[model samples]
Target chain A: MVREIYQAVADGILVGGVYALMAVGLTLIFGVLDIINIAQGVLVVLGGYLSYSLSTRAHIDLFAGLLITIPAMFALGVVVHWAFIRRLRGAERTSMTLLVTYAVALIVEGVLYKIYGANNVQLSAPYTTASLHVAGFYLPWIYVYGFLLAVALVAAVYLLLYRSRFGRSVRATMANETAARLVGIDTGRVGALTFGIGVAVTAAGGMVFGATNAFNANSGYDLISRLLAIVILGGLGSIAGALAASVFMITLESVVTIWYPTWAIAVFYAALVGVLVIRPRGFFGRKEVRAQ
Target chain B: MIGERGAKAGGLVLLVAAAVAFPLAFPDPAVTNYGVFAMIFVTAASAWNVFSGYSGYISLGHAVFFGSGAYAMGIAARDWNITGAAVFELLPLCAAVGAAIAVPFGLIALRVRRHTFIVITIAIFFIFQLMAFNFSFTGGSAGLSSPFLTWQESVYDTRFYYIALACAAGAVALSWLVRRSSFGLRLRAIRDDEDRASGLGVRAMRVKLSAFAASAGLTATIGAVWFYYVNQVQPQTGFDPLFDLTVVLMTFLGGYGTIAGPVLGALLVEPGTLWLNTQPQLAGASEIVLGVVFLVVVLFVPRGIIPTGGEWIRRLR
Candidate 1:
């Protein structure tokens, strides 16, 4: 029993790492642009589809496929911003973004359905099925690779934010957009670039996610809710907070599944509500969140 | 002033009478079925507008109340052998169940900011959906069939049509009454600016909670009626998050925070969706079109049709 519990925790942390990568992208966009990308889940699915096509058609390795998919997703993000998100202005921008992004989600989901026919597909590779025996627990190679990739990308993001010129602009914008503009950071460019980068990371997250779980276009709906819960529990725009909350939530869900399989999914959300009731700002959130 | 009030009241009565007489005038089962759906959507959208449109707290999880009402009716009918008039009488119980769920749901979820509140609502909604799928009482994923009404087909349709119209009328009337009251003013104030409203002693929490509870009750009543009309309940249909999204879209498309907006929205969108569903070549086209419509409306006409039309009329004058 104890070994099974340990295995669940081990499995959860690995899966949670991928969640962290996806959530960081979401949080990054929220932190810099004050826009919640409601389309994030669909974008991840798009990434998975991209990877799926590349791996199946081009015979590219899953990890190697990110080199192509990342840039493609980034460009897609930029185009989306240019076409849809850029024109939104004024006090209702946040709420308006919610609706507009939902529309974006719908369009993408429709296109996916048209092409894929509502079938669940996963990225397949030898590593996906292989497991590593570590002590008494068996760890899947894809999870191990996913976790390592997540750590690397998260570190890269941290470095980009804290150690580079672009990072400085992003942080400045996050802190105060008006000030960032006054400092000649070209805030518009920063916003576009940050959104692109935010979406680019989804390639990695989605590849691993697709490999781990079978997904169709409609799967994005469930994914969005779970991702949103993670980001919200992690304090919306906080990077490290996203990391902590992802692991915590995934672990809790796994443990619950072990004892009460029925309550696993519900517990994920119930914990979110309970936490928010106790600490409205979340674990590391600011007192006054960016209001819509 | 008295004359103007009388004119408005008379107009309202005329409108209600027209709506009540609509299905009878048509006399087609298909048309009446469409009427039933349209009326149900009107009530649902109006219920959504009561809280979200008034308070600017967009709930993506309204299906929680909707599903609760549906499951409540389903359980009562299946377990207690409820049928016919007894099942119809259970509408109040469904409403109560909805309100009961909202109390705790609102207390916890309402504490967060608007953005976080959306997340909480989605979370709670999924939780309920998952529970419906897992709990044996809800009959798991297979769901529960509503008891037979034992009426003639046309009579059943007519009965449900009237019931749906009454529920929709009640929702709209309640909304009208609320909009005229001080409580509605508080809700609007919260929507405009929560901090400022609370600073001015509006008791934001209580006002929001009451509005949420009221909205849930009305929505649940409609849901219960819908369950009866459909004669079945399942997690997918009963707890569909997309249903909540559709209601929000309808309210927005019509005109949020306005008395006549949601009614107008439901009238237009529901029938349009039904028409789209009938199209053989355009499978999955309605959703894509609705998405584009939502984007176009939000970008170009955020104030919605009624307000924009009103503005245009004033400009013409």
Candidate 2:
């Protein structure tokens, strides 16, 4: 029984890493732009589609395809942020951007529907179905790879934020946009680029999502709901908080699913409400910096 | 220039008259079938306007209340043996159910940020839908049928049309009253700035919760009427996201913050949707159209169709 519980936790952590990767971009965009990109979920779909295209058409491996798709997605994100997000300003910016991103989401969903129809497509590879016997439990290779990728990318994001000049500028801007601008930082440029990078990470997350599950254009609807919940529970703008919250929530969900699958999904949502009720600031949320 | 109040009143009178006459004049049964859906949508959009347009808390999950109302009416008719023939019995039950469903859903996400509120709304909508789908008594995905209305009765469609029309008119009139009342003013203030409203001694949370409840009740009444008209209620059919988006679209398309907006939105968007749904090629394209309209409205005319219509009306005057 204890072993099974341990396995569930382990399995949950692995799945949660990939979720954290998907949610990190969502949180990052909110952190910088103060706009919840409703399209983030769709962008992840776009990433999966890109991988789908690459693996099926160009004969690239799913993981290797990220090498090309990440940059492609980043450029797409940059253009989107430049064209649409940069124009939004003022007090109503957050709500207004919801409409804007929703529009973007629709446009993407439409195009995907036009191409892919309503059918669910799953990514296939040798390792996709391959499971390794680890400590009396079967662990899927895709989950392990996906978790490693998430951890590595998260580390890279940390390095970029703490060690690089661009990261320094981003942190400065996040802390105080006007003050960052006063210090010779190009806040506009940082914001747009950061927004792009945030979206670009979804490429990795999306590949894993597509591999693990069959997805149609409508999949983003479910993905976004979960991502939004994770980010909000983690503290909207906090990366570390997103990681912790993602693991905690998903683990709870996965463990519960073993006992009662019906209540499993509801448990995560119930946890979000419970946490918020007790500590609205979330587990690692910074003091005095409300989600607003 | 036409004052906002005068324009709203004038538009309301004209709309009610037109709605009444159109159904009554529809000599063709097929044409009135179209009217029924349009009327129901107008009611839902008007109810959506209460919290989203006026209070500025855009709820993407309004389908929860709508679905609850649908299920309530469905269960009432199926289990209680309540006749859909009676309007008064069903309408109040629907309204009460809608309010009950929305109050807690509202409380769940009331204190959250704007986007988070949207997320919660969508989540609750799906939760309600899934719960309904899994429950056997509600007929799950197949949806429960309305208590058998007499098909042999010649006035079935005509009577259903009246119910839908009445529900739409009530939703519009109630929205107008709520918009003009002090409660509406307080909601508008919160919409503009919650912090400022709180600073000014307005109980922002309380005002929002009440608006949310009222909105839910209004929409749910229509759902009950809708169930009667359609004769069935499926979880997915009732709690569709596209319908929720359509309401948001119509509300914005007509004018978000105005009493005339939802009416204008329904008048404009519903017909186009019904017309488009007729085409097999454009079957799924309505969503695309709505998305495009959402973008255009936000970018070009953030105020909405009614406010813009008021502009044209003022010019003519």
lDDT of 1 by residue, A135-195 (tens): 9689999999999999999999999999999999999999999988998999999999999
What is residue A50's positional error in candidate 1, in angstroms?
1.1
Instruction: Give the C-alpha lDDT of model 1.
Output: 0.90
TM-score of chain B, candidate 1? 0.97
TM-score winner among the candidates?
1
lDDT per residue for candidate 2 within A1-292, as digits (tens), equals 7888898999899999999998889888888777788898988998999999899989899999999989988998888788777887765577778888888888889888888889999999999999989768888999999999999999998899989999999889888888999999999999888988998999999999999989999998878878888988898889999999899989998999888887677777778877777776667765433334
Model 2: per-residue Cα lDDT over B29-140, one tens digit each: 7787788788888889989997888888888988888888888988877776776356348779889999988777778788775766777777677777778877788887
Worst 10 residues of 2 chain A by lDDT: A283-292
Off by over 4 Å in 1: A290-292, B1-14
TM-score against truth, every candidate? 0.97, 0.94
Best by DockQ: 1
Against the native complex, each candidate's DockQ, computed on alpha carbons, is 0.68, 0.49
- In the range B1-317, model 1's lDDT, one tens digit per residue, is 89879988998899889888987799999888889999999999999999999999999888998889999999988888877777888999999999999999999999888988888888988988988999899999998888877899868788888999989989998899889999999999999889889999999999999999999999888888888888788999899978987998898888989989999999998988898989999897777888888898898888789899989987997
The C-alpha local distance difference test score for the whole of candidate 2 amounts to 0.84
